[model samples]
Target: MTQHLTIVDHPLVQHKLTIMRDKTTSTAGFRRLLREISLLLAYEVTRELEMTTTTIETPMQTMEAPTLEGKKLALISILRAGNGLMDGILEMIPGARVGFVGMYRDPETLQPVQYYCKVPNELDARMTIVVDPMLATGNSSVAAIDLLKKQGARNLRFLCLLATPEGVARMLEAHPDVPIVTAALDAGLDDHGYILPGLGDAGDRMFGTK
Candidate 1:
């Protein structure tokens, strides 16, 4: 991943994102759309995966075939809401190694606090991708990246459904090498660290929680 952000604005991605953002979309409908859109985003995120040629005997003759190089990818999901995106991505990258990092914001300090973390072994040797549906304040995402770096992750990428400018800025400042891929970048964050004109509470919308 480059030291930049990529917004997957393909028609299929945008269409599904629009429906997901609508207030009338049911929990089942939203969840279904998220799963479908996740596959689309996965296409863009893994577009540049390293490929190597392998000698294979085709039905006609022997030939060289392109295949992905290196070990299975490591997907680190920022827990709770990240599961929504991770589920669909896992369906596509079925061989990927999965891990979870759980964190929550402190109401008083408005900072993220980590509670749980379990990552795969030899993270530095694999391509590590982090999934979180909404990048609101970036506090949690940055914190999660910090932990992953400590765990030996060298190649990192961040994927989200929606992002705020503040959040993106924070990530760039903290981890410029980790590129970000998102469906949309919203106007900004509200007073309480919520994205403006954004779908309210991604976890709640997907899980029917308040």
Candidate 2:
């Protein structure tokens, strides 16, 4: 991903996102749309994956077949809301290795506090994608990538459902090499770090929790 930030603009993605943003949408519905949209976003994110051709025997003839250069990819979800995006991405890419960073925003300071982190081994050799539903303050995303770099993750990308300009700029300043792929870049965030005109709390909307 050469660009710092890539926003998926497919019609299906926009349609599902519009429905997901509705206040009347139920928990089940919201979760379903998120998952469905994830599949599309996953496609866009992986579009630039390195590919190689291999010789393959077709019934009566041999031909060159295109295949992904690497067999495994590392997907690190920034929990707990990141799990929502990760689930559907997993469906599309069942062979991907999974990891999690358990962190939460401090209401007062809006900073990320890490509680747990377990990522795949040999991250430097694989393309690592960090998944999170919202890029509100960007503190958590930046912190998570910082941890991954310390753990030897060199190749990295960020996948999110929604983002704000402040968040994108922060990520660029913190980790310019890691490209960002999101469904939409919404208006600025509110006073409490919530996205404006955003679909409420992603974790809360997906899980029916406060």
Candidate 3:
């Protein structure tokens, strides 16, 4: 595995991920699992955030305590599936700013085409975490990062519920600077661009659309 990719193997994350992968799991259950898993994943992803000591008066006495330093974190969700992960992460970091990037696959070229892109102010100043549920081909993921880099997002990290080996390779080759945090990395992608033995279409499963 590449150093840039961090596969979290916490028990809670694994448990919820397995439940989300089960075909018999209900839509509501799946959504709840994703949210639960996101909280654990967010904790791992944000572990390296900078902190500084600040003086504050406690109930007993005044004391200096560690607090998050610098600008507020920014989360850029690659919708619409990314929104599912984003919601739970937001719950964990309520003060963090939110952004959205929308892209749809171009059937003819099998490439991602941007339909929307919106980020908060001073993206360059804040550490940006791009959230998506799956990393299959890595085309969209790469494209999204390209756009963010163009907009001056330097310190970036990618958070996904699952990934495939092929997708990890693609991402490593294209955007090595952006570290990836995922719960599981499956065998590889299937014929139709789905992760094999992976939780079905995350968007459909999450929204109960299919």
**Model 1: residues >4 Å from true position, as ranges?**
1-3
User: TM-score of each candidate?
Assistant: 0.97, 0.97, 0.96
Tell me the deviation in Å of residue 14 in model 2: 0.5
Residue 129 lDDT in model 3? 98
lDDT of 2 at 67: 91
Clashes of each: 0, 0, 0
Which lDDT values do the candidates have, in the order given? 0.91, 0.93, 0.92
Considering lDDT, where higher is better, how would the candidates rank from best to worst? 2, 3, 1
- TM-score of decoy 3: 0.96
Please give, for residues 1-210, the per-residue lDDT of candidate 2 as tens digits.
238999998999999999999999999999999999999999988877779999999999999999989748999999899999999999988999999999999999999999999999999888899999999989999999999999999989999999999999999999999899999999989999999888999999999999
Model 1 pairs in collision: none
